[model samples]
Structures are given as C-alpha cells and as structure tokens.
Target: MKKWLIFSILIMFGIFNLNEPVLAEAGAADLTSEAAVLMDTQSGAILFGKNEEVKMYPASLTKIATAIYAIEKGNLDDQVIVSKKVFDIDGTRVYLNPGEQVTLKKLIQGMLINSGNDAAMAIAIHLDGTMEKYSQHVNEFLESEIGVKATHFVNPHGLFDEDHYTTAKDLGIILNYAMKNEDFREIFGTKQMKWDGESWDTTLLSHHRMLKGEIPYPGVTGGKTGFVDQSKQTLATTAENGPLKLTAILLKSEYKKKIYDDTIKLFDYGFSNFKSSQVKKGEVFTSGKRQFTYSADTFLTDPIDEGNRTVDSNGVLNIENREGKVIQTVELKPIIKKKLEVKNTAQKAEQSGVLSLNSIVGGILLLFAVGVLVLNRKQKRNRRYRSR
Candidate 1:
C-alpha cells in the first residue's frame, strides 16, 4: 500500500509537469555585419541585435527617410522641373537633363527604385528649394514625426559625406514607419518600373538582390540597398510571413552577399522563434486591487515557447522571455470603475449626512411651531380669564 501511494504521487507530479508549457531552447544568430537589428513591424520589438544602437553610416539607406519624408510633405501630383544641380550630383543617376520636367511622384519612384541620385537631388530641391534647407527640415521631420534620435542627414542622396550618418536601429525604425504609408510602401517595394527620363529612357530595376528575386527570399516585400567607401554594403529589408511582419537592417558588411546572408539569418531566427499575440481592447488584467485595460487593440511579440506576462502596481504589463528577461513593456490604462464606485459611495454618504441634518432641522422647526401655538393659546386663555 505504501509503495502504491508513492507511485500515485509520482504519477500526479508527472501529469502536472506535462500540463505546463515546454519551452524550446533559444536560437542564435551569427551575423557578418558590423551593426544589425531585426524588429517586429507591428509591435516595434527588437528580436535580434548586434551593435544595433552603434552609430554607423547608412549610405543610400538614407533614401528610405528621404522618400517617406517627401511622400508625406510634398504633393506627388505637382510638376517639378529638374534643376541644374541634379545633373552634377554624384553616384547613381536616372540621368535627367537640366530643366527636365518630371512629376514629384516620378522623381520619388526613380530615386527609390533605381537609387537615382539625380532624382533624389531634384526632389530635394523641388520640395525645399535647396539641399541645406532640405536637410534641416528632413532632420526635424524625422525627429518629430518618427522619433529617431541618433541620425542626421546632410544630403538626401546617400553619397559619401562625412556629416551624413545613421544607425541600423534608426534605419529599422524609419523603414517600419515608412511601410505604414501607402504611397511610400508602393514605391519602396517596386522591383521594376519604366523610366522616361530625357537622357535615360529604359526600365529601372531595384538594386536589392532579394527584392529583385536574385536572392529569392520567400516573403520579401520591400528593400533598400546602400554602399559607399565609408559605409560598406548597407541593406534594409522588410518581409511578412502569415501574421508576422519583420524588418531587418544591416550595416558595414564588407561583401554584399554577406549582408544578404546576415539578413536571412535574422529573419529565420525571428520567424521561427517569435509569434504575434493580440490583446483585445476591453480585456482586463488585474494587479492586486487594481484593474488595467487598453483603449485600443494592440499586438505583442512573444516567444513561440514558454513566456510569462506580469502586471505591476502601476498597471504596466511586462512580457518576459523564458529566462525572465523583459522583452516588452506596455503601459495599460487603469480601469476607472473602482474610482467611480468610491466616488459614488462618498456621494451617498454626503447625501445621507445632508438628509440627517435636514431631518434634525425639520424636527426643531416642528417643535418651535408647536411651542408657539401653545404660548398663543395660554396668552388667549389668560386674556379670557381677565375678561371673565
């Protein structure tokens, strides 16, 4: 009997353990780039990073910011005359002649799809009148609109400039922000478009290998490529698999193939290990006596394996990996029901007090009226006795 009982307890323990989630072993990413980051497009969570915050040259990746900025701030339908400065600008060109009239939208397409330095210069000059003002306005737009801190651009084109620099993380943020805009998304993902320039009238093909089907990634939606002597082989790529959308940024790889390879590794790790989880707007979470909920639906990036969520006293929801490291934190709005209940209770108490005071005043007035009637009757009786 004793042995049987011991066996039964062991079996119960095993069943309990089996019911709990089994955490998969964490994956590793080996990359060749000097700085890289893989971010969740929906939740803005960083899944992998190698010196992501370190300052590095962005090369033509600068155009990602430039393209999005122009699309939002400039009128795409407006006709922009190509300026003389566009012809002399260095690096890749769509080969526009001086005084060539092109729509602002066409210039943006040429700049993004073909890495046209001339197109970029034309757009910059057309929108802001000069490169100097364009740089200042674009910088302000990036900081105020997109919330990038460690980036600055002296020129719209990513030509070699000592003052122009951005980081892998910042590039990821910019790409993520840009992808939300419809016009920017359509232009950024174009693999090929017809070019009708004064000097160059042919097809403009994307320089990104994966985007152009040269590398053949499965879910590659958009890409931007950049390189210069100072900033070697920079690349930005966005991909989607089912419900997961990811952005990968790589900077300072010696070889183009190596940067592409690094991007593949980052994507593989992200898609395999992480999954998206949703928090509905009205769903409530409790922390002791407090309850928290979101006003709008939001998504969270969670490990495919075991993870935990904890709500703190301040209504902050912390999502942690299996190792107890916090991967994401969301500030939840406190549910105001409890506060309303307390206020209602206080109001009732105040009303009760007011009613009690009213009752006391009524009783006093009743007794004073009765006393006045009795005194008037006594005075009338005394006057009747005197008359008798």
Candidate 2:
C-alpha cells in the first residue's frame, strides 16, 4: 500500500511518469509500402521510417531534381523554341509540336503538375542549352549541397533509366533542401497555378485533386505525385498541423489515390503519436555563469509571421543535454540608443575601447607638463616678492 502511494505521488510530480519508454508498435500498416518516411519539415527530424535507406528506382519522382533546376535557372518569360528532339522524346509530354513556342516557366509547371516527360525534356534543354548539362547540375547538387550519395539522376524527368536511383532517406534530404528554397517550396506547395494572357496565350491550370478535399484534412497543403509501370507509384506530401508541420514520402504505391491514403495514414500516425518541443513567448533563457540571457517574444511592429517554422513557448528554450541538464539559449536583443554593432564590445572603456595606448599616454603627459609649469611659476613669484 505504501509503495503504491509513493508511485502515485511520483507520477503526479512527473519525476517518473511511467519509469519507462513507451514502445509504440508501429502497426503493420506502415510496412505496406516498400519504402516510407515521416519527417518534421522544420527541424528535419525523422519521426518514423521503414526501408528508408534501401536502394530503389525512384521513377517519375526523379523530376524533383528537374523541378529544382528549372526554378534556379529558367525565367518564366523566357521563350523556348521547341527543339525537334525535345518534342520527340519517348515519354509523357505536354505534346509540343516542333516549331511551337512556350515559356520555360510554363513548361516546368506542366513538367511537375502533369508529369509531362517531353515538357521535362523541353525545360531541361531550355535551361542548360542541353539536357546533358542540366543533368550534371542535378548530380553535383545531390552529392554536394544535398549530401546525398544514394541519389543519382540521368534525366530531368523521373523517367525510368537503367542508371537513375534514389531511396526514401535520400528523398528526405532532397526535401530538406527544397523546403529551404522559397521558389521550390512554393512550387511544391501550390494547389493550383494558372498563368494566362502571355504571348503564347496559355495557362497551366494544375488541379492536384486531393488538395481540394475539405473533410478529414484541410491542412494538406500541396506536394508531388510520381508513377510509372516500372517505378509503380510514389507520393510525397506535406502539411501544417498545429505546432508540427511534417512530410511523408511513399514510393511504389499502388495508385494515385493510394498515395493520398497512404500519405494520410503516415501523417495521422505522426500527429497522433509524436509531439515536438515548444519554446514559449516572453520566455527568458539565462545562464549568469556565462553572462548570457536569451529572451523570446520580442516585439516587432507586427506580430511575426512564422512561415516556415512555428513555436509555442511558455517563454523560453529549456535546452537540455542527454542527461537532462539545462543548457541555456542566450537571449540577445538591442539596448536603446546604442549601435547594434557595439553589443560585441567590452564594458571597460579605456582598457578595451577604440583609443590606442600612445594616444592615452600622450594625454597623460600633457596634463603632467601643465601641473609642473604652474608650480614653478608660483615658486618664482614668491621668491621675487620676498626680495623686494
């Protein structure tokens, strides 16, 4: 009876809430897809994963590279003359006829939204002067900036190539890079994009159908869909749900609808089971020993719009190590009427200020000279008065 009483009291204080880690059995539902990953879109932490690092053909998903390349290089207004070879590429297409005219920007939208293989070829050719050079940029970016070794691309479109490959883990890395780029994120998140009244007089009216649903998930923003007989079906989706905005990628899914369903399940699992840490408003993180104080909820003229990230702070980042010790996040802000650059300066003025040693020494010498002259004149006057 006494042991039970003590256990109950400890639980109330949260000293030992359960005295053990809660091992959730990630149900077999997660294993249905050959590869899957759920990640925190902000901090890029993996919440759940299966066969994440396993190598596989990424199919149309390869266009992730193509889309990013187009965003970086091509201007929407730049007219691309349909090359004879681009119109003839053997895959999906916007059905460009040779001698046709289209903007590189619209071609990209078609490439991503319609998964048009020929559009992909057209955009690739337009951006780098040839498909070959654009593909080199993709390879270098994957290995260098994205830090992905398992991912390699042969085409701007994710058409099946004997050499092209990626994994669920590599997709996470790519998304991490993509999320940081405003243009890339915007393209990925767009539900519908319509551009009309240009010289070519065309609009890319993208209807990513699932994004229109109002019932279960109003937060499903936007993402990409990939499929081919060889790659089966692949979907990568993202959403903003309260404090957590997250993403889930599914490869070799059955149909486009299954991509939505599977992605929804993965997101549901992440939101229902896992919760992230919050740094509160007006919270002060202080370490007197280190002479540091980090304050949150600082005032701006307008309330800050947390676009890519969100926070809930009772007031501060209670940063902790593995041992659960508080490592302070130094809160820093400007003081009134002071140059912001001066914040790095020391308080000791003469000891540490901008004036040099010779300047200070010269001032001291001038003061000493004046004092000696005054004393010498007073002594001379007193002797002359006594003699008179």
Candidate 3:
C-alpha cells in the first residue's frame, strides 16, 4: 500500500509538470552587438530589442534610403550624366568616367548591389542637382514620407559623417518601409548583377553573406551591409517563415561573424516564440459598453503562449507579451451605437403601429355585432306583436 501511494504521487507530479506552460527563451542577453532590434514586418511589432534607440553610425546603410527615394522620385529610364565630382568621392565605386552617361535605374542598382559610393553620388546629383540639396530633400522625404524621426543623413553614401547617424530602431523602420515598394524589393534581394559601366566592368556582388547564401540561413529574403571605423559593422536583414516576416538590425559589432550570429539568433527567437495573428475586417471587440472594430484586415504578432490583449475605453488595442509589456498598439474605430438605437426605435414603431391597427379593427367588429344583435331583437318583438 505504501509503494502504491508513492507511485501515484509521482505520476500526478509528472502530469502536472507536463501540463505547465513553458516560457520563451530570451535572446537579447545573448547578443554581443552594441545595439540590435527584431521587428515583425506584418504588424510592425518589436519582438526583441537591446539598446535599439541608441544613435550610431549607419555606414553604407544610407544607400538603402537613397535607393528607395530615387525609385519613387526619379524616372528609371532617364539618362543621368556622371559628373567629375563622383570620381573624387572615396570608398567603393563603379569607376564612372567624367562624362559617362547612365540610366538612373542602373546607378541605383550599382549603389545597392555593390555599395558603390560613386553611383550614389551620381544619383544624388541627378535628382536634386547638388549633394547639399540632395541631403536636404532626402531628409524631408524621410520625415514626411517614411515617417522616420531619429535618422539624419548628410550624404548619400554613408561614408563617415558625424552628423549622419541613425538608431537601430530607426533603421528597422526604414528597411520595413523600403521593402513595401516592389522595385526596391527586387533590387535589394539581388545577389549579383552584370555591370556594364563606362570604366569598370565586372559582376557586382552583394555584401550581405546570408543573402548571398554564404551563411546559409533559411528564409533570408534581403539584406544590406555597412562598415566604417566609427560605425564598426552594421547589418540589416529580412526574412520570412510561413506567415511571420521579420526584420533584424544589428549595429556596432566588432566582427562580421558576430553580427551574422546575432542575426541568426534574433531570427530563431522570433520564429520559435512568436506567431502571426490576423484580425479580420469588421471584427468587433468589446470593452465594457464600447464596441470597436478594424476597417481592414490586419496582421499582428504575439507570443505563442501567455499573451494578453486588452482594449481601453478609447478603443486602443494593446497587445502585451507574457511580461505584460505592450509590444504593439492600434487605434480601433468605435462602432456607432446610434445606428443600433435607430434600428431598435424603428422596430418598436412598427410593433406599435401593428398593435394600434389590431385594436381599431376589434372595436369596429364589436360595434357591428352589437348593432346586429339589437336589430335582431327588435325584429323578433315586431314579429310577436304581429302574431298577437
């Protein structure tokens, strides 16, 4: 009896342990980079962040903004004349001659695929006529169009200007915005392209190792790499697995391998712990007496377990992680109560009208019956009198 009781207790304890929810493994503490961020592209949720808001040099990542801006603002087919100024710019170059004429589209391709500073200078000059003007216009465009607040660029090529700095969170925002444009996506994902420039003729290759398959990470869609003495090494990577799309930004890493490792870690954490949840169009959520709904279908990321959703009285939906930190917030439109009230009022009026009509009909029938009965009685009396 004693042995059986002990065995039963052990079995019950094992069952309880199995039923308990497992917490997600935290990855931020394991990263070696100075600043990093992981964002869900579908819902714009930050899954993991470490020093993400600290301003640091972006290095060559500035080309990403320049490329997207040019794609949206400049015509692809327009012939852009290379100036002598581009030849003097230091760093990577497509080696353009003084008067070499190239299409705006090709220059953008060279700048992004090969990280060519010369190509970036040419695009900047062609679009806004001078580097200073280009900087001013691009800054305005970033703030007004892309909605970035913490990023500022002094030049097109992120060569090393103290004034040109952006945080990891801001870079993540910029990359997410750029990935929305189809043309930018195509160029950004290109591993290698044939370059038929005026001076330099070679196959331009992407510097991002994972994107080029050198690191061999699954679901890597696009990437951008940057490096300078001050900025160290910075990387932007985008990946997708089923419904979950992720963007990772790593800044100020000392070595190339470490940044890539950090990126893989970030991706693994995101894919393993989080899931994409869809809120359908017109899906209604209630908070006390107020009802709110989304006008269009929306996707959001949440933890696999222990996640909570709460709506405030103002109809703001807050998605919280297991720790109760709000990872994302969305403003939901209030469902108008007046329409329902009007519908109920109309129903009540129709019912009242029906009742009134029934009462009137019943009264008329009763009066008719009374009149007939009286007439019948009078006739009977008259007949009796005649008989007598």
Candidate 3 lDDT over 1-388, as tens digits, reads: 9998987898877843655433323566778889999999878899888999999999998998999999999999999988889979998888888789999999999999899999999999999998889999999999999888999998999999889999999888888889889999999999999998767789999999999999999999999999999999999999999989999999999999999999999998888878997899999988778789997888878888888888986778999989898888888999886445788889999999999999999999999999999999999999999999
* C-alpha positional error of residue 295 in candidate 2 after TM-score superposition, expressed in Å: 15
Off by over 4 Å in 3: 1-25, 287-289, 339-388
| Candidate 2 lowest-lDDT run of ten | 301-310
Per residue, candidate 2 scores C-alpha lDDT tens digits across 1-388 of: 9999999998899898554322213443544577888776765666667788888778777777777767765677888887777646776666776667788776777777666787788777777776678778778878886788888787887878777889997887787667777867766766555644223334554435555453257577667777767788787777877766777888876666666677777777667644555445544334332222234542211101211221123323243322333322323532224355554444455456546777789899999999999999999999999999
- Model 2 TM-score, 2 decimals: 0.63
- Expressed as tens digits, the lDDT of each residue in 1-388 for candidate 1 is 9998987898877853644432222223357789988889888887777888998889899999999999999999999998999868888988999998999999999999999999999999998998889999999999999999999999998898778888888888899999999999899899999887778889999999999999988999999999899998999999999999999999999999999998898888788778987789988878778788886788898888877888977778888877787767888999876335788899999999999999999999999999999999999999999999
lDDT of 3 at 377: 100
Candidate 1 Cα deviation (angstroms), residue 21: 14
Q: TM-scores of all models?
A: 0.81, 0.63, 0.83
Clashing pairs in 3: none
User: How should the candidates be ordered by TM-score, best one leading?
Assistant: 3, 1, 2
What's each prediction's clash count?
A: 0, 10, 0
Candidate 1 vs 3: which has more TM-score: 3
What is each predicted model's overall lDDT from 0 to 1? 0.88, 0.66, 0.90
lDDT at residue 207 of model 3 (Cα atoms): 93
**Candidate 3 TM-score over all chains jointly:** 0.83
Candidate 2 global CA lDDT score: 0.66
Which residue pairs collide in model 2, if any? 92-117, 279-313, 280-313, 280-314, 280-315, 283-315, 293-331, 294-330, 294-331, 295-331
